[model samples]
Target: MFTTKIIAVILCCLLVSSNGLQPSTCSNQGDGNYGCFDIASQGSCTEVSNQPASRDIRWPHSGIDSNIDWAIKCGDIIAYKIQWFSGGWSGWYVPGVNDMDTKVNNGNGLRRMWSYFYDHTHSYIICKTNDSNKLRGCQ
Candidate 1:
């Protein structure tokens, strides 16, 4: 029984460490409270706003999900996009003070982040790509 218990505890520890667990910090930014999902892992990345008003949080992965309330102020035409290993790009999402969240999936979570510039016609173009940053296994 002692050996079994020891093995179980070791396995639990390994699982926790391998899952890329981390702490998150939240604060009020710009118009409302916002944060960055900072992820340093094998195949995931994000563009985190490291400002005094912004906060930091661990990016979600398989079986783990996250919801974000983008309190976008007027005249700010910025949005976030994500790309997966197999699903490709997920286009820009203008949360615009709405609640946006990512779904849990088997893929290596989100792999990329993109900034968009919205035009008068309600269309947007890729304005920036955080290509210089790469996660653990992301190319």
Candidate 2:
């Protein structure tokens, strides 16, 4: 009888502990910051400069799975990030120039796309005249 009681207690303890343990999640608080459920946080975004700048884009994954699709112009660059329940968050991966257009799983946690400017200047100007001819490929 004592052995059966001890086994029941152990099983109860395991159930309680399992209920308390849950998977971590990252949430985009909308201020360019990804807030984590268990850990501290992922990161944030910064302004864009002509010299070189990057911004961190975040998405939350509670249950549903999704993907993020983006496009870039000029000479900007981009990268991706993902996190799993087994391992920690993955490092930033810079995709090749020809592989710019792609989609990533949203459940992998908040993803980031970085845009860079190789020019030595910290500012840029886009000239758009009223004429259709002036509508260049600046868009």
Candidate 3:
């Protein structure tokens, strides 16, 4: 029974750690900084400045411009800020909000906003960050 309890505890810890239950210790690079990770390599970090300067919006529709290419994937944890044409910013959506508000809210609104941004009707990509520098991406 003792052995089983120990194994259970160990499994729980592993599961929590893998799910980002632990805090991230990665260092911040300040504003206007970008961290790069090789498309082929994993567990490494670098800096890249070649990201797109601005994204075009189609107005009636919401989505990113077809010409623009996103470096990260859908499930990939990344940082982004919400911009409005009226001249306002919504702050960085780290972990895409769903991961952040897992327990508090259902994250339905955040998910919708993200979908709108992805569709390209809103604003452009101002800045972004990833988790290459830390154990996980965009923690």
The pairs that clash in candidate 1 are 41-136, 42-137
Please give the CA lDDT of all the candidate structures.
0.36, 0.36, 0.39
Residues 54-89 of candidate 3: C-alpha lDDT, one tens digit per residue: 333421132322212233321332444444455566
What is every candidate's alpha-carbon RMSD to the true fold? Answer: 19.2, 21.2, 15.0
Candidate 2 local lDDT, 17-134, one digit each (tens):
8863433565566764566454223222233333332232221221121122122232222444433234354444454423231445445432222221221122322222233322
Model 3, position 16: C-alpha lDDT score:
82
Candidates ranked by TM-score? 3, 2, 1
For this target, which candidate reaches the highest lDDT against the unseen true structure? 3
Candidate 3 Cα outliers beyond 4 Å, as residue runs:
1-40, 43-77, 96-112, 118-139
Give the alpha carbon lDDT tens digit for every residue of 34-123 in model 1. Answer: 555554322322343311222223222212122222212112224544444353545556543332444333463441122111111123
Stretches > 4 Å off in candidate 1: 1-77, 97-99, 102-139
Rank all candidate structures by their lDDT, best first, as comma-separated numbers: 3, 2, 1
